[model samples]
Target: MTVREIATEAYRESVPVLVLSAVGGLFAGVVLGGWTPETEQVAGLLVLVPALLATRGNVYGSLGGRLGSALHQGLVDPTLSLADERVNAAVAASLANGVLVSMLSAVLAVGLLTALGRPSAPLATLVAIALLAGVVSGLILTVVVVSVVFVGYRRGLNPDTLAGPVVTTTGDVVGVATLLVATRIVLALGGG
Candidate 1:
């Protein structure tokens, strides 16, 4: 084959790694943040980072994997260059999945926190707070992932390489920040 063709094939092969790296970075951040030592007063919130990160990764990673399939099947066309109804459907499906996963994560996080003897708030209240934070962060993450993938695709970039890394890293930053902000809000409101 010609050099041009070889270059094209090489670029195509690199897409998947790009996508996975993005998501992996986000997960790594969560794990790192969770494992960080807290001050004596904040020890109870130790699980906040990992739990939130795990949930974010679960929700976003699943969606990313699905999108990867859609891309593989010629179903992803954000620029209207590839007329495929499946792309739109995939976006909708992924959004829904992200929201649902966020809620579930919130519930589990609250339960785990309570079990660990952190009763700053009641279980119900904690769940509500966690769910709200999770959902918000998930929503943001979904939008970011979708937008990044679309832009990358339109620019003739491979989703495999760009999507995963961008989505995962962005999600990690957003997830940690969101958790901290939400926790602070809950504490302030509850006068804890």
Candidate 2:
């Protein structure tokens, strides 16, 4: 593509994602700000935040990559009216990864906190919050990434270019919100 073409396509392809990303950023800031006091009060929860958020991004971002590859290969429909097999498989794998990774991340976070002689939440509480938050956020992000990829493909744009940034941004915002809710629920349940 020529420079002018590239510029035009970039503007066309990226604007929606960028605008949504800005919204996501604002939501993330709110979630962070609101969650900060509790997170500081609980030692292990703060550590879980980064790992939980990263897991959401990694899982959904990879799903986007696979879908983009399939789009390029003429394997995916621009729509999912028939419930595409590849998309189903991708979602299943992503969910499985979300559950497993969230559990592991919680364990790792707790371990690290203990190693550092930091006060820690109960192991079960940390694990529950991480697993619940990660799975919920991952599911939401999967849908968002899939929608972005489908729209990008339908618009004759490369979904690969659009998916990464969008998924990461969505994951960050939704992940934090999900964590906050899960933490509250866990604490209410006497887990914290």
Candidate 3:
């Protein structure tokens, strides 16, 4: 496709994902509301929220962008399989980035809170929750992002436009939900 055609297609494809992202964000807001009590229980969990969300968006959202680029470059086959070396490498990198970045973000959150003399959860607990939640959210996002990219491609849509918005929205919802679960688990183990 020519540049104008590609841009138009991307714009068209972005519409649905943007709509879904808004809807999904609304749900994530509700989940965050419910998280109030849990955050109170583990003070630092509050601090970790933004970092976790950023990690998700940065890692998985970028994964979508990379996949789209690969498809456009024909480095990754148009098929949805990991049979392509490029696809395998990208997936592995995304997964690693998701987990590691989240853990580091947790540490950064703790450090930031400490520097400000704010009360926060211990580094260990924060790290644990971030890692666990990151894994859960990451796994869910990987499948969803990959599927959406392929579906968009098969439907003659640009994956670039759809993947980022969809994955980020999903990351918001799944990331919060998984973080909540991880927090509860931590509380159960150590009384928050």
Candidate 4:
């Protein structure tokens, strides 16, 4: 098939997955609520939510897309009973992308917040939280996205059709959960 044909086919297959992702987002939004920080705490760790989640979703979603391509090209096995080199490559790629995306997102978010005159806890605290949260969340997101995509592929579903939406939606949910947990940990340390 031509490039256009492949693109069209991918788009067509994505319709159902898009619907499912939307539903997942709505469900997550309701369950998580605003998660907005109070006026007093607005400048603290609150702003990390969007950044962390966006990074998680983008990186994992991108990886899923690649995995889908690998699947199509017969470069992937369902059991991943591949050689050590291949396994290492997959893990390295996922981690590298995840870390890079997370750091970029965090930096961008911090810059945006600063530009908007938002109060921040401290430069060190902000950086620490952003980097730590990014790394930790990225690792978890890697597992979640890979597992979901692998399972979907095994079931004869197109990863391109399902991975992005599923990964992004789940990333939102997981991201929020991760941020909240991280915030609680920080608060606990601060004797809150």
Candidate 5:
């Protein structure tokens, strides 16, 4: 293929995905905007938002990339199955990392806020919210990343080109929405 052909192919494959990502981002923003009451009730929750979302994107995005590479190399099949040890391990590792990072982010947020002498919710409350959000979002993102990468690959599209933006956009939307739900659950349980 010539340079023009390569460019055209990349554009053709990536533009629609990018457009979808933009729409997903706008939807995530709408969800966040509607969660003002939760944020207000849980001090320092806003601080956790970026970190949480970024962690999801980074962790799950890497998982997507790895799966893409594996599929390309024929190291794993392009199907979601626990019977495939490689695919199972990749997903397990991503989920563990997601949960650990989520908890760490909450702890760091609380410590930072306390050091700065700013108001923050209790450490336990933040940890609980983080834990809940992390598990739920991690599960959801795992399935999503796997599905998108596999589907794109099967469709003759490059998963490498699809993984990053899709993961980031889905991560943001799912992370924020999960955080809101977790916060509500924790608060109702007499946390924070």
Candidate 6:
């Protein structure tokens, strides 16, 4: 293919997804901005927000990239199934990393706040919230990233172009929603 053809193909495939991602990001921002009460109630929660969302995007985005590469290489089929050991393994690893990094972020946030003489929620409370949010969002992201990458590949679209934006936007939206839910749960349980 000529350079112009390649450029046109890439632009055609990616532009729509990029536009959708921008809209999704705005939605996520709205949801987050509307959660002022929760943010105020939970000290240092804002600190955890970016870290949590970034971790989801990083972990799941990598998972999506790996799956895309696998699809291209024919190492895995473009189908979600338990029989696909490579897919299963990749997902499991991503989940593990997501959860672990989430917990670490909570601890680090608390530590940083305390070191700076800033008020922070109890360590246990932050950890619980992080853990809950991580598990929920990780599961959701795994399914989403896998499905989008696989389906886009099947449709003859470049999964490489699709995975990053899709995962990042979805991760932001889901991460914020799940974090809010987790915070609410912790507060309702008198933990926060």
Model 1 C-alpha lDDT per residue in residues 103-180, reported as the tens digit of each score: 565566667766786654445454555566677787788777766666766676666566556666767777766766
Worst 10 residues of 2 by lDDT: 34-43
TM-score of each: 0.66, 0.91, 0.91, 0.76, 0.97, 0.98
Residue-pair clashes, model 5: 0
lDDT of each: 0.63, 0.85, 0.85, 0.69, 0.95, 0.95
lDDT of 3 by residue, 80-181 (tens): 775777777888899999999889988998899899999988888888888889888888989988888877887888887788888889999999899999
Each model's Cα RMSD: 5.3, 1.8, 1.9, 3.8, 1.0, 0.8
Q: What is the Å distance of residue 25 in model 3 from its true position?
A: 0.7
Clashing pairs in 5: none
Q: List the pairs of residues colliding in candidate 6.
A: none
TM-score for candidate 4, residues paired by index:
0.76
Query: RMSD to the native, candidate 4?
Result: 3.8
Model 6 ranges off by over 4 Å: none
CA deviation > 4 Å runs, candidate 3:
1-9
lDDT of 6 by residue, 21-98 (tens): 999999999999998889888999999999999999999999999999999999997766679999989999999999
How accurate locally is residue 172 in candidate 6, as Cα lDDT from 0 to 100?
96
lDDT of 3 at 184: 88
After aligning candidate 1 to the native by TM-score, how far in Å is the CA of 32 from where it should be?
A: 8.7
Model 2 Cα lDDT, one tens digit per residue, 10-94 = 8887888788888887889777887766786567888888898888888888999998998899887887644788889988898
Off by over 4 Å in 5: none
Can you rank all candidates by TM-score, best first? 6, 5, 3, 2, 4, 1
Runs of candidate 1 exceeding 4 Å displacement: 1-43, 80-89, 113-120
Q: TM-score: which candidate is best? A: 6
lDDT of 1: 0.63
